[model samples]
Target: MSYPKDFLLNLYKTMVRIRNFEIMAEKLFLEGELPGFIHLYIGEEAIATGVIADLRKDDFITSTHRGHGHMIAKGANINRMMAELYGRTTGYCKGKGGSMHIADFSIGVLGANGVVGGGLPIAVGAGLGIKMKKTDQVVVAFFGDGASNTGAFHESLNFASIYKLPVIFVVENNKFASTATTKETTSIENISDRAVGYGIPGITIDGNDVITIYETAKEMIKRAREDGGPSLIEAKTYRIKGHFVGDPELYRDKKEVEEFWLNEPIRKFEKKLVEEKMLNETEKRKIWEDAQKEIEEAVTFAKESPVPNNEDALTDLFVNDSGYDY
Candidate 1:
């Protein structure tokens, strides 16, 4: 369970980057600088950061709708993410794919999906590619608790398990999927427990604790790389924000929301670091201050960057149609 000082520091930095990025994205959304719906990755930062931190640079990942944290943790540039949200030409998707679809294939980020549980199959396909090519690259698929009920989730895992594909399915069980609490929709106590049917090893960990998440993720990642087959990791965490920007969150109790913030994953993580003498309060503050500065610079870049031209509107499309192609 011992990690090198550099690895630990990078983990801390990734989590901080995700947290600050979400906060800044919210601000930009409220200001009308960004378009479309955004599902903030507020409390679920540790799961993405922990899982992807163990991955190789050439390894692949597919993300869910609430994917900013995963992208940032997976080495996505903050400026491009901000520009994507801004729908500028400098975006990862060239101003076409906004919040739900920012992708950087060069770094092995397959793409972020707007559909729930959509990334599962893509990740499985990537695993298939890896196995065929005899590469050490593994694919990590991230989704929410609600996505577990979808057919794609079950099918992809089954295929991965049957073929012994090199993929890790990470379920960020953030209590509620959108507006409905997971308890109301499903009877299972632990989502990872469902992996039994698929014949894959399943383990649940405190998604709030970065160290705990890192430990479990490292094991699963290593297992996959060694061709041991795919594993399902269900991270028990909470979502601190409403499902999307401008959501009043009438479905959740106000007190419950307040409680989650008081015991937020990032805050809890900082407490653990200080208690273990891994980091002090002053050091934590410095970390946060630096993250804030990085976020500010990203925002500035987004604002200063020019929007995509009207003539280029028809360009960058995957398909070509005669008259419609501008």
Candidate 2:
């Protein structure tokens, strides 16, 4: 349980960054400043922050719709991410792909998928390539409780297991698939239990505890990089926000959300840090202040960036087909 002081501080900063970004994003989306539907990673910040902390820069991650946290943890450019939300030309996809599809291959963020469970196969493919190239890079595929029920999830796990691919299947069970609760949808008690069928090691942990998440991910990622094959981790967390910004949220009781708010990951982690004397009121305030400044700069950059040119719509749409003056 002993962690370097700097590492623990970095984790806290990362989680703060994610929380700030999601809160600002939600505000923007509600104010009609953002163009597309954004799934906020508000309560689930710890899972991404902890899981991606153990990954190398060259390691790959396939993200779900609620993926800003993953990219932030992986060190994606914040300004470009904001630009993408604003549909500006400086975005990762040049304004073509918004919240759901922002991808930066250079950083090993394959893409943020709109389709549930879409990232699983992509993770498998990346793992297969890493295997073919004889590299030690591992792939971490992120999905939700709903996606865990999809056929792609099952098939990808089976294929990755058989090939002994370096892939980590992380299921962020926020307890709801859109409007449906996990109890109403999923069959098993724990999503990780399904790994038994795929013959991969699986475990469930308290997703809100950043330390626990980081340690679990460290072991699993180390296993994959060492050619021990795929594994599954089900992180039990909650979705503090509605599925998307502006969702009516009629499905859940306000009292329940209020209760979950008291147990949100950031607050829990902050309390731990404070008790450990790693953080204090002033330090915590500074972290939040810094995140706010960074997010504000990104918003300014996004607002000032140009929109994609209409005439160049077809450009970069393909690779080397006898280009017709696109």
Candidate 3:
């Protein structure tokens, strides 16, 4: 899998952007600038950046609660996203959905679900729609290791297999589902092994390696677009933060977490690029500086945006009849 130098550089830039955005979001949340819970994608940047790089703007994706990276990688405007986090009127969900429910239909983002395993069925339905409409577009469903155990996962996979829907199931096996380690909650050694029951191709790879993820996603996405049916990919990675902001995270040892930092995906990829002569120290610094600058601008935009009007609360709500008795 030979990627062009420009392509590789773009990947690096995307990862850096995601990282910086998450870091800024964390700081904002801690400083009480942003409302609600946020699941930071600090250490898991490579998986989203690499996988999304292979997708077309029209290609659909179902995101998880930890979905900011997916949205950014898929080209969602940082200003709107930051505004949403700030609970401002100029947001993706008009200041209502906050961190867990951002969606851009024009770009094929079905939206991120807060429920565990919630997006599975939605992804399957989207694939069915694409097939019925006779389009070449494919859908990618991003879920965590914990979601693979949910009933929705089984039902969606079975339905996709039986109908030969063009969808890719990406399992981000970050070793833990919330606070519980996956090893204690699941019996299978590999989450991808479950794909065998659906008779779809299942392969697990190093989620930290952006090149590996990019190559694997290219093949699976190509297969789906060609009407070759669905495939499951398990990317073994780790979350660098607690499940949500302010979490105590007593489940794991401090030393274990500290050790994992040494193998952080962003640093590893930066080192590889430098060694391969694709990027110099000055170039890498420029990328980091540019990402930080973009994030700062986004934060400013969010802070300056107005809050949603009190009367506008019922505008986007499902039940619009204010007179209805509860």
- Give the alpha carbon lDDT tens digit for every residue of 137-189 in model 2: 99999999999999999999999999999999999999999999999999998
Clashing pairs in 1: none
Task: List model 3 lDDT by residue over 1-326, tens digit each.
Answer: 26678998999999999999999999988998788999988889999988999999999999989999999999999999999999899999899899999988889899989999999999999999999999999999999999999999999999999999999999999888999999999889899999999999999999999999999999999999999999999999988899998889999998887888888788989888888888998998999999999999999999899998888776654565664335
Per-residue lDDT tens digits for candidate 1, residues 8-96, read: 76788888989999999998789987788888999888899888878888999999899999999889999999989999888899888
TM-score of 2: 0.98
The model with the greatest lDDT is 2
Which segments of candidate 2 are over 4 A away from where they belong?
322-326
Mind sharing the TM-score for model 1? Answer: 0.95
- What stretches of model 1 exceed 4 Å from their correct place? 319-326
Q: For each candidate in the order shown, give its overall lDDT on alpha carbons.
A: 0.89, 0.94, 0.92
Q: What residue runs in model 3 are displaced by over 4 Å at the alpha carbon?
A: 318-326
Better of 1 and 2 by lDDT: 2
The TM-score ranking, best first, is 2, 3, 1
lDDT of 1: 0.89
